[model samples]
Target: MTPHEIGTTFYAYTAASSSVAHILDASKPATFSMVNAHKRLAILIHGFTSSHEDSHLQSIKTNMLHHSNGEVGTVIVVDWRHGASALALPPYLRAASNTQVVGHQVAHLVEELRKHHGVNPHNVYIVGHSLGAQSAGFAGRYALSTFHWKLGRITALDAAAPSFENHPGTFLTKNDAVFVDAIHTSASKDHNPLNGVFGFVHAFAHLDFYPNDGHNQPKCHNPLEIACHHEAALLYYDASLSAHNSCKFYGFSCHDWATFHAHHCTKHDAEMGYFADKIHASGVRFLATTEKYPFCH
Candidate 1:
């Protein structure tokens, strides 16, 4: 659909939803523990085959709030029903309907939030990890086309670079997201063509390549890890926190990690601990009240 058309739909959706007194109540903080009353809204998109608890999502949410002062704003963690078999999908079909559907769902959700709580579209930002990055890209594009949604930023952390490679320019309009930024990690051992293609895009505002060899860092092969950070997702996010605040874009990889070996989750936890602390210091703005992890002070 044309971008203008999409924007109209988004506006109508938000307005209709707002008229319901219970809509805001339905979106209560209990719905998303970290969400607060006054702060702006930030949506968290999980990587492919991953959940909100994934390290990358956790790290980004932690970091953004860290930089914003314990008040990181509202985080809406998106979860899709795509089966775990996405790993097995012939690369071609993976980007087809799945990408469009998820993007639409997120857009719809944003409208609901905007109308219900008077959230400013310009203040809304989406931080996506892995496949979630692709979701952020599509959502941003949809919003841009509709014109009703203007964002502070859409940060794609090592976004799913492969699935969108061959799609027509319709998916990516020129300068579509002026405020959009991306970060990619070269340290990842995954050799997928899509990943390579995704890395080539000039859309990335900032790119950080990690060392190819490091102690304790594992290869980017585990499906769960690949699903989350096969190329060490959280670690990549940790390295990209210091840049300016315009719709962050970051990528990461570790040194000497193979695309076959396995690593433990604690290894990820350690990385997150450091990132969480750094975000708290970076001045990213967040909503008060502890949810998953206390906003590092």
Candidate 2:
């Protein structure tokens, strides 16, 4: 699809009580200036079949505002729902193909911020879920390759694994940004029937966090609860940003899950979610969580 054919909307949220404001029309360059250059910018991308209006996305935005203590300058929700609504293979393929184009468009907006508005690329953070996570990677890659700007960070919430597992460099990676952290909530398990229920099992970021083994989460007993597991990535991220978060998601550095489970791998420690501090670490890390609400604690 051409740049004109892709429909991406940017909604700006300034405060906790603030209603979403349409700040940018992707087709119109003039509207790009509506982005506030003074405040730190956060761009959120939702997964397939979801929109900027998604409840999970809203929760994260609200919590981020609350956690930042009004420090968060601006929150931009990237709506590419038109390309992500279809559940079939063809639509998924279309969405995947459009990822690069959307990334270019986003990079262009950031460039406008830098050139005209004086926004620092280091203050921009991109957060995405599932397929949206892959899109975030593309945006980071495009920003550096096309604009020579390295994004501050990219948070991938259980990036999709179905079509992207074998395609390296197609999804989020550590090199996409200065710091890339991923939360794998639902990955395929050996001899398990509910494989590929939500996320990719691979370690796609500098710090790949596997919460509750990153497969079937606690309290998720049925297949229908897949949303719970998939959405957990966002929940953890939201909690990590919330001031009320009392539980810290500490992970153990391990070569793999087997070594982690066998207690053979243990050398360094890492933190997960919004406040993750180990941006320099590489490889998979394991952590545990509660079965109920406020899963972090």
Best-matching candidate per TM-score: 2
| Candidate 2, 1-297: lDDT as tens digits | 666555777887767435657667644667765566777688899887889999878888877666765556778888888767685458777877777777777778788778867889988988999888888888888888889989988889988776677787787888988888999888765523254466887677888899878875786777655477787888778777763446677788876677777878666477787777434566778877787667763
Least accurate stretch of 10 residues (summed lDDT) in model 1?
283-292
For each candidate, the alpha-carbon lDDT, in order, equals 0.43, 0.77
- Give the range of the ten consecutive residues with the poorest summed lDDT in model 2: 188-197
TM-score of each: 0.56, 0.88
True lDDT of residue 59, candidate 2: 80
Candidate 1, residue 95: the lDDT equals 36
Candidate 1 structure, TM-score to reference: 0.56
> What's the distance in Å from true for residue 94, model 2?
1.8
Clash pairs (backbone) in predicted model 2: none
Q: Which stretches of candidate 1 lie over 4 Å from their true place?
A: 1-37, 81-92, 170-178, 186-230, 239-297
